[model samples]
Target: MKFNIKNRVTLLVSVWMMSFTMNMLEGVCSIPSSLEVFEHHKNVTGKKWAVLVAGSNGYENYRHQADVCHAYQILKRGGLEDDNIIVFMYDDIAHHPKNPRPGIIINEPNGSNVYDGVPKDYTGEATNAQNFYAVISGNRSALSGGSGKVVDSGPNDTIFIYYSDHGSTGLVSMPEGDDIMANDFMDVLMEKHATNSYKKMVIYLEACESGSMFEGILPNNINIYATTASKASEDSWAFYCPDYGLPPPPEYTTCLGDLYSISWLEDSDKNDMTKETLQQQYQIVRRRTLIGYKDFHSHVMKYGDDKLKNDLLANYIGANPSLDENAYSFEPSTTQTRLVNQRDAHLLHLRLELQMAPEGSKEKLKARQELVDEISHREHVDNTFHLIWDLLRDKNNNSTMMLNVRPPGKPLVDDWDCFRTLIKTYENHCGRLSSYGKKYTRVFANMCNAGIYVEQLKATTSQVSIPLTSSSTQTLDLSSIGSSFPTSATLQELELVTSIDEELLQEYGDELHRFGKVQRVFVVSLKDRSSHMLAMTTSFLKGDYQDELRFFRVHKSDVYESQVAVTKGIGKYDVANGYAEIKVVDKVGFSTKGGKVTNSKFLLFHIYLS
Candidate 1:
């Protein structure tokens, strides 16, 4: 059946950022006071285990129920059985929109059909490698004494865990009624008397201001990964809470909690993607995750606490060094103010690398507990914190003042040919970084029109390598979504609002508005690695879709802010070097006008159609 065209009002895309107050005690100490030994690669292998801990009580305030389910399913699919996992549930409906189960599904349901059956926890089987799974299905009062397999599980397991809820400073609040300080979790694992039990543990924590617990405490026997850098409540609104509300209520839309997990899993996958490729995907995933959350924040800010950390980032470095090797070079004095003797500099760097491990929190465990203090005292470590043995000890070497130098690998890649490739790759992996490690900036408007497209969004091909630092702009084509949605005037209006020229402005604006007339439209703003939904208007509007409208999205590698910010600053739209992305929707139909001339109910007079 043919339908009439109607345009509705709607916000096109939603953009938000998370501000965090992270506890960075380890980041400060791990600055590498000397130099690193990257030339000589190292590897530590052992049985791997993953665990997911979820507290889904308040769905309205800290809604992360989907994340809980996603974590469980992924773990099970990855070969983790009932024996190696655990889930904790609270009686109250605080974390989840409504009370929910730990894993949304069971490994093997009682019924023959997979989707037809119910979901269950992983506590049925007992595995060979001491692998186990436990779940605390409701309330925090039970958590204190509820040390299921988590306490008994060895430190060596590759535990990928998550805590989704409200957090202040170092404390992660439990529905049990009180907050569990971040330091408490670290104390459980970092203190040699306790943490030494595990061999290699990796903790992926999700909460607010989680970075605070990291102060002074270095991860040991485990790898520590966090969502943000500092304690920031205002950031969450920008991070996940919608500015207005989600899917406009009665329409609970999806959130961004699983984005990071997806990227992490994909990046680590040995299948079609390499570690390098996966890392690149992380930035995209991270940005997309933020976008989803931003839409959420925009949808639900006024209804609840607006103070929120709207973003997530890797606050801890817990990866173990894969190799150790070095190549020597002495070129001087430009970037650094003071120039030192080439020979002394080389020696200084060598001294520093001797004591420290390059990556991973597993090896750092020994260092954090003073188990290596005996070795540290007798050795003369270089600026990089490398500990030297008795024979090489130099009392005069400065440990506090020295800087950590990275051992030589490949040629210096400051120039674009090499540097751009690497940074761009990082962006592809983490989505937060440009292929190189630069922050992305948004210019002009929310979308960019590269050219007049039809069927596919193809742009004028230019630079092959990303991470390029140059001021350039390209046109995008339209016609894929429709051909007759918005009229010329509507297109002009859209272009003017979005900031396009008069000539092409009207054409683009009308086109966008035409798409905006659909029953419901999903608008995507690709800015700074984040793919956010700008609009979810049930009744689309004529002015919403712009055929050739232009806007830009912020996407980059701030991995810090470069990882999530839409652009550096507001206003200033310098065309130097920037990129933008957008997605639009709409509906249209013919219109006719007629009059009942005879008034007999059955008699119809002249009909006018335009």
Candidate 2:
């Protein structure tokens, strides 16, 4: 084992090199003084810019605008000048008829008006998704109309963006317009990065399912940090809800702030911005937002650059107390507070309105009906999807309904195109899924998670129909139906109260389609015992009679010849003996030249798919 002097020196050198490599691999722990030379440690050298957007309108959504206005106050106090800040709010709240203080808007209980000095760079319809993207990407031409303000920043600028609104799984609503879908927003961020818009950006989102905006799309290297009020599949909570008996001021009947939003704003208000870091504020806010509401707790989430956590709050918010003369103090209470689900906030408000109104009065009855309708609408959506789920279960032997697969605490469908398509289809047929339709996005998400194709889900929906309950059924006397309404005396209409055979239903199903897609058919039946009839109506496309299902029954007097009359009307060979030939019009709903067309009264003998 004895080695020569040269070998021994080689061994010692090798050992020394190995030790050096190990030290390099496991980064050497350095003292704070030694780390001062690191570029990140040096004070962030940049001018600050901000974009605060409140992407919702209406008085019940008071919290969104209030959140944005409050954030504006914080950034302004932090010394970011008005010239450097861009604000986009619906701007309807300050002067809203519902506002007790017409010109002032408040965030916290008895809080000072954040709306007083706020800028209205993009207001009204101008505060839409198009302007939002335009502002983010600095694309003046992309915006249809607005203040034409955008983020005019360089690599040295730090940008802070705060958006408060109503959000579905992958969409944030813009007032009077389409939503800010995740894909589009992600594209804007990428464009901003490519154009060297900012050195770093901090985004705060206060909306239901806000985390979906960044969940799988945001890249960690994008120099962006996002903190959302709720996770990918949960509702963000609304706080200071007077409807639930917790109001900052007595007259404030709606929610004043989002739980996650107000938590951070209040924390910013109380803490020394110079001393506190963004990480500390996030932790405080996250804790406060999740405190005590375990039954329906919204999990706050953070995405992108973990390193940005150590950045000073003052770097983005501002440290100049002198500039905060208009800012008011906020004391967050841990007790006697309630949180409202964003989807149900308005319903709760209506419920409270009903309770406060004089008993049995018109206003009270109206409020009660509104509350009931709201509740019923939500239930109807759930019930409709449940019906689809039941049909799918029956058709597939209960195999594809996602009953066995457990989803994450929050369920989300990561496929954007598929989700968009499914949602659009639902909207075209069912109605806008926002507000009442928001929560049902999860049904599609579940379908996606279960490895079910959107096409299959849509097709399933097409085949399903809502049957009227026995209690809702009315036995119509066909003889007297539609007699009260005017119709053409030359044409006789016969009402048939009968059920179609499965074979006939299958034949009709083959002809049914959606959006002109020959193969797609969605059947939705009336909740009342109403009948749909297949009419030999004159086609607007061909100017000839075609077989089409008319949900409304035609009366004898209501069936009239068109203003542009045809000598050879719909022949008996083209339709049934008792069937009336009718002309098509440009408007929706079945209308006749007669006095008025009444609703169908016959029990439509339509075939039902098993």
Candidate 3:
């Protein structure tokens, strides 16, 4: 099944005409001077290089990849060679099973096939933060896959970077993996500056809360200029939406372009690239992306060197060597100008699928379930965070939690360490905080605004527990007993205490019966993002003070404070495969596995230590 649509011929023709018009507008005398200036720049600035990245995958996110391909097309037409332009996209949408057009991708409602010649320098899982940095820093040794083509640029080169993806405050999601944190990304830029990788750089990003990447952290003197689709607190929008009158192909059910993305690209397509200054282009994109739609929009923002706005678009995007006066031009009708929130596009498509599906059919049922799950997942995440908030408020009787912080959204402070600790604590106790957990980030911001410490929040949430016996109990003070019992005490001491109170020992293995006070618990998840392995401090036994348990893949420098003991008979049961057992032996370094055993590993366990 494929959508039968012609690649817009005018797209190429307009490029030629626009370039011609720009040259014409510049006048004959201006052309020689402009060439002289560019030639001088070429001598000083080695080459122009671009890194185009679309940080998402799947059929539903067609627009992101399409936007990147379109950007590549513009840069290519502008004169940058393929080797100078590095592209990072999942490269899955064009031929996706669900794609209406098997080998084609369009940016606008009735646009050209932008995907035809886009480079696949890096694709799939390789399009991650690690690879992105490896490419930017020209460290081929750090690259994981693809052709391993890096920028290979020097201080004399000019760099342009464009990234389109799903983003939240301080983080951007990478497909099927962890996110790219703003601080880490800034570190990469600082590294580039420190190494003199380029003379000047330009960055354009399209994502929900894209501005957060540069709003406060990006330094202005770093020779980098940036623009984002929206402010840190808002969602970027999609254009040519479901209600755009022209129905999408039968196999597709969503918008064709991102609002801010298409606004700038289309402006480039229509106007003269040579004549268009970056400032003029920004004004055009800002106006159309925001006010023209009158439906859904976001505040497009710019950061870094404001003077760079006067530079020619050709300096970054490139310009054609010659133009054609007889080229074709295009202007979309009002019917094609609808918009929707980019973050909600997939969910909206699923709902539309269910709405349009035949009643009680398999397709209808499948769509219904997907829609329900999507909504339910979001609600579940919100409910979980709200539960944590309520529990903490109730436990501490802190009326400050009742503060009205909702009407006007609050900005997240640059306190990355605070937010990271708080998020880790929640995940350590609750579960893996996935994409849905991102919506709760603002709650952490609110907590920070309320002057709450991360430890205090951790303590409040740690109070939640499941009843283990007929009598409910609060946190236990085992440090007092630890004072009398030395780490070198006989094995009989361990047996004597457990034997004396077997019930209490069995009730809480991870927390309650502590011989010496537990200092910290470190949780490690597999690199494949699967099951979690836990390590906890058992006693202050000097060299061999801690105990290690279970299995999860560890990274190169993943250091846990505890000792390492590879549990034997580990493969006998796999948790993800539905069979697992966990036990805490009276003696250290003892391992037992086989049958499914229920313990703290499978339950929500808490730990509080002095």
For candidate 1, what is the total of clashing residue pairs? 191
- Pick the lDDT winner: 2
Model 2 misplaced regions, further than 4 Å: 1-44, 243-246, 292-296, 322-337, 358-362, 393-411, 449-457, 463-610
Identify the runs in model 3 with alpha carbons over 4 angstroms from their true place: 1-44, 245-251, 321-338, 356-360, 393-411, 428-436, 448-610
CA lDDT of every candidate: 0.27, 0.64, 0.63
For candidate 3, the per-residue lDDT at 388 reads 61
Q: Global lDDT for candidate 1? A: 0.27
lDDT of 2 by residue, 288-393 (tens): 6776454546888999887788777777777735433333444445555566888878866675666666765897658655664555455556656665677566
How well does candidate 2 match the true structure in TM-score terms? 0.67
Which scores better on TM-score, 2 or 3?
A: 2
Clashing pairs in 2: 78-318, 462-522, 462-523, 486-557, 487-557, 487-558, 488-557, 531-604
lDDT of 1 by residue, 468-498 (tens): 2322332333322222232432323322122
Candidate 3 TM-score versus the reference = 0.66
* Winner by TM-score: 2
Per-residue lDDT tens digits for candidate 3, residues 116-163, read: 888888888787888888898899999898878888888778899998
